[model samples]
Target: MIKRSILAAGLATALFVAPAFADDRPPTPEERAQIEAVLAAEGFTSWDEIEWDDDGHWEVDDAVGPDGRQYDLKLDASFAIIARDPD
Candidate 1:
């Protein structure tokens, strides 16, 4: 139905727009500390993209490892690595 299509489009647009706003705010100092811990542990130099998600987890994207591997990492509030997947 037209109503459903319109609603879907609006939802898609909101999802896309939301990240733009989220990116405007860099990681908090506490968050940066947590993220840094992960980088140090994994021997990564820096984070290409780091953001705090609604789930209270820091999602780190494109972390270049010591061996030159790109990694996407997730950390919980305590900064523990909950997930690490290759980019």
Candidate 2:
């Protein structure tokens, strides 16, 4: 009974954690280039805190704008700028 219980708990944990790890991979070069273009247009001189999400999109946690401000942004799978929010 204890062994069965342990197995059930393990499976539950795996199910909960699996999706959280799914988007941890880095963006491909094409995606990176696409993001670069959008950022450049927006005057983003530098960026950081990038991550890939389940929709096959990438989002920047924050970026350094040419005007000396920071902001957040997102790009769709095609590298199109989907959203932006300045900090």
RMSD in order of candidates: 6.6, 3.0
Candidate 2 residues lying further than 4 Å off, grouped into runs, are 1-17
Model 2 C-alpha lDDT per residue in residues 1-87, reported as the tens digit of each score: 999999999999999999878856676788677778888887889998677877767888778878788878878877777877898
> Where is the poorest 10-residue window by lDDT in model 2?
23-32
C-alpha-based local distance difference test score of model 1: 0.81
User: Against the hidden reference, what TM-scores do the models get?
Assistant: 0.62, 0.65
Candidate 1 least-lDDT 10 residues: 18-27
The true-versus-predicted C-alpha distance at residue 56 of model 2, in Å, is 4.9
Q: Give the per-residue Cα lDDT of candidate 2 at 7.
A: 100
lDDT per prediction?
A: 0.81, 0.81
